[model samples]
Target chain A: MSSDILNQLKDVVLEFDIENAEAVAKKAVEAGVSPLKAAAALTGAIREVGDKFGKGEFFLPDLVCAAEVLKKALPVINSAIEKNGEKANKSLGKVIIGTVYGDVHSIGKGMVATLLYVAGFEVIDLGINVKGEDFLNAIKENNPDILAMSALLTTTAAEQKNVVEGLKKEGIRDNVKVIVGGSPINQEFADSIGADGYGATAPEGVKIAKKLLGIS
Target chain B: MQKGFKRKFEPIKILSSSQIEQIHSASLQVLEEVGFRYDSDKALKLLQSNGCAVDYETKIAKIPPDLIEESIIKTPSSFMVRSRDPEKSIRLGGNTLYFMNSAGARYCDVDTGIVTMPTLEQNNEGVIVSDALDTVNVFPSYTPYFEIKGVPPVMSCPVSCAQRMRFSTKPSRGAQPTDTFIWETQMAQAVDAQLMGCVEGAAPLSLAEDACNAAFYYLDAGFPIYIASGSIMGGSHPITVAGASVSHNAELLAIVVLLQCIRPGCGIIANNFVSAMNMATGDLNFGTVAVALHQMAYNQIWHSLYKIPINNTGSAFSNSKKIDYQTAAEKLPLAMCSALSGANLIVLHGGVTGELAYNPILAVIDDDVASTIGRIVEGFDINDATLDIDTIKEVGSTGTFLSTKQTRTLWKTEDYMPRVFDKTSYQEWLAGGQKTVIEKAKERMIDILANHKPRPLADEQDREINKILSEATKYYKKKGLI
Candidate 1:
């Protein structure tokens, strides 16, 4: 029963079946299958799907749905593991990301956040029009390894610099590595804003996040 | 038949009646609930006086459904743009489709297909080639202004308008949706041609004051106005195609209402240039399957319901910076969809990479593409003569009729013959040095430039157009725009 339920959890992730993933996770807990074991199984499936996506077999929508399945199943399994007084596992890293103020663009932010989460980071997405104070608060609350900000408009790009200045004001500038990106962002702009790194794309964002956290 | 003969053909419809109504109803809801703002004081006061609920502080105008409906009804279904030569005039609306060469590129490089600021001579060569292309029916309102020397980049609009007026007798449009372009339209009209200009709407239901004033200027000048929306999804509009389309529709309807209010029964053309923003780059993405579907759906919705002619930037926009396979791949689907869906004025005959670059070779290739699409849109007639029952009976038992009278008479109109695309045998092709479509297009372009001469503007008309140019330059110089 343990092996069967564990394999079923992997199947749920591979099939991108969020509802089935949640149901199977609950059933795994009820049947006395270790939630840690179920989570490991699901993570394996996610890695395989991510690899396939890297090989171009899957598209953006496929990766998004697969990530969603894992997301839905995680809570059920995490609670079960907590009930057993055992931790699931350590994540690769934690990230706080948002679109800067005056820009209501969410797709790029959502994309990087999803990819980072899929790569095993604990991501706290602040969503669109996030102010500098919100970034500072999230930095204080989450103690994130990296803080990423995106702004599509040239006008809103100044907000990225504002957030960096806010971090400096709180004396937390060195606590977290800051990464800036968007359509108009470049390495020069990133350096000018005192960002530790800049990502031109979502996948590149993931690599930068992992590198900043010293995660393989 | 004349070379580059313009004709009418039925457009293909891809949406259901219920779906059309769904979009319409959704659009109307946007207009009433989430109104777009107009930045123009003149436009807002006009709308407020016409019983619209106007918030002067925000400049938002929530137009009633009846007002939008009435304006749509008042817009002319079709209008003829007469050229200096009566023989070259064409109607824009109904089943008619006119392919115009792309305008507004800062560069015109063909050899390497790399974009750079072109010289005036290169730009003039482009205009002359466009005049010679059979598929290109009319000159667009704007062309690449910076490419031409002597005309300050700021004065390109007024300067290029005069250049096009002299280059071709084909009726053209203006590039600006502002009062500055209004003067050019006025000049074109004075030179015995009516120039149409577009007035763009700020998406999410707003029309700015400048665009509104531009529309009014053209209308007041007794010229037609193309109500355009350049809404980029996920940026200026909602992320979803349908949502963005709703915003576009609302903005267009609101502008139409303002036009009707300002001058009842003014000539207005429906134009949607809505494109999605690429999430990866945050750039305006014009070459995507989603964009093609959006254009097709827009044509279907507007043409079917409003009975207004549709104009879309078809096959003219691409993200590919060069004229290569990617450009071809991106262009064919868009041109095909726009053609099949039956957009009335399909612009961008030879545009590449978001239309920041123009090449005459690409233009010639696009002419071939437009011709093929025009033929496809000109779906064959199915009456007895085309059905050829008698001919089929006479040619029974697999008899050949290559030399028959019917074959000879129908061959010209029955099949589309591409001028630049080759259909030669492998041996003949190899023996002829293996020319590619681009190579052949380049050769054709050279031939046209060397030999083809556009009908010259009358001497008196030339003087008047020059006088208009000098006056415009002086006026713009005083304004410090040049």
Candidate 2:
């Protein structure tokens, strides 16, 4: 019965059904199933969705939907695992992603967040038009392993450097790795701003996240 | 007042008539079978009520060919765009051609080649330069590369529009009609000059909410809407130029149909900013021969069949991050093809790479190119005055006509003089400083900025425009946008 609940949970994620995925996750928890193992299966399912996306068989909306389902399912499983005196270590790492202030472009940041989540990272998406203070607060609260920022406009591209400088001023620069990206961003800009890495695309963003976390 | 040139000769056809037809039919099929998504509820409902099959959950609409055909018939082939000064206004069909500069270029890195946002003063200076160029029919909204000291982006539009109106009397091209400021800017423009609303169509056959709102607003306002559809090949479209053209046309036509539905006979200019994708870097390459081919194809097809004015980024919009050899090579062909393809309006002043940055010096250089292409497209006349058969006879074999009456009378009209081109011989050119084209362009830029005086807006009109801008800022601040 527990195995059946787990399989149902994974299927819900694969089908990108958010409500069902959450409900099935709760069912697996009620059935005394291993939450971490179920999460692993869901992660595997999300990875399959990413593979389909990379292969051009699926569009951005499809990948986004699948990620949303997995995102909804994760909390339910995490709470149940917490009740059992166990930690949810199924995540490869934690990341905080947002578009810098003065820029409201959301596509690039959302793409990176989705890809990173699919690559087994716990992503805290801060959305668009985020200020420098917000990045510092998110880093302080979440203590994430990576901080990814995107700026689509040249006007706001400088804010990426501002966020890094803010981190330095707060003495938290070494606590998290910084990744800057967007259509206007390049390696020179990234290095100028002292970013740890730069990703030109969503897939490349995932690779950068994994590399930063020392994951193969 | 310098009005732009008109093409008296035939446009070069890169694609045969049948190929254009096949592409059109294929696009209609794609619309009917594999409909694109529309992010606007208003558009979806409007299309559905108008005989389209719409899936509400996915917001996808499959439009029938009959509806598109019916809508196309209502669209006028030509219209006039008025300016504050009637003399500066332009007609938008036939062989008439116009040139305009770029708007909202955040950076001006001409000296150090280091990208940095421009200040409002620098932006104003750029406007002065654009006003001085005889080739640019209309000025563009001049925005600082960075945010102004106290103004938010949402409110920057009205300020920029007001500033441009104050400094230059030429009609200005509207910036990003997708923004809410476009509404505010239009409101400010209503009191004075006319603006051609710039609306971009989302690729892969979709129309997002902002784009839809912008299109509807301009069409409703009775202003000419410049509908630009940018399709990055292999990203949101097919890899091949022909296939990308098909997708680009579909996207443009879908919006055209919607515009016609909103208001039949509304003025619109079709623009396709198609480019290829660099697979290795995952970057959309704007400066490429393939992109030039796509621009030419779209220009020819739209002009030949639709019988309306077409806008193209033919002379500008490159992928080189810096102004270098690659930038020149890529921009030249695209601009030449655009002029030859009979594009009615081509954007001549723009960025070096991917429209991410702007350099006014490039505009000066491109102005020279526009002058040259203008002469080429004019095609030499066989009329007696131009043919000068009598003059040829008078001069004969080795005799000189250097002092002839014809030479003295028609010299200005007969020869195309470029402002930035080096006419001096090699030794004299070196003695004059051996300046590169960029350096010569800079000298002209400095001269224009220093001496050219744009016709100023009336004092009362200036006060009224500033009041409108202040109101817009207050409204946005109330909404907490600032």
* Chain A vs. native, model 1, TM-score: 0.97
Please state the error at residue B329 of candidate 2 in Å.
1.4
Return the lDDT, model 2, position B312. 81
Task: Give the least accurate 10-residue stretch of model 1 chain B, judged by summed lDDT.
Answer: B1-10
Q: Which stretches of candidate 1 lie over 4 Å from their true place?
A: A1-216, B1-11, B144-147, B393-395
lDDT of 1 by residue, B148-185 (tens): 66667656777677777777777777766335675687
User: What lDDT, from 0 to 1, does candidate 1 have?
Assistant: 0.78
Residue pairs in candidate 1 whose N, alpha carbon or C atoms collide under 3 angstroms: B36-B205, B40-B209, B141-B173
Instruction: Determine which window of 10 residues in candidate 2 chain B has minimal summed lDDT.
Output: B140-149
- What interface RMSD does each of the candidate structures achieve? 24.9, 30.1
Q: Write the per-residue lDDT of candidate 1 for residues A1-216, one digit (tens) a residue.
A: 789888888898777775576888888889998778888998889888888877867656566777878888989989988888998789888889999999998777877887888888888988889988989998999899899999999999999999999999999999999999888888889999899998877888888887887777
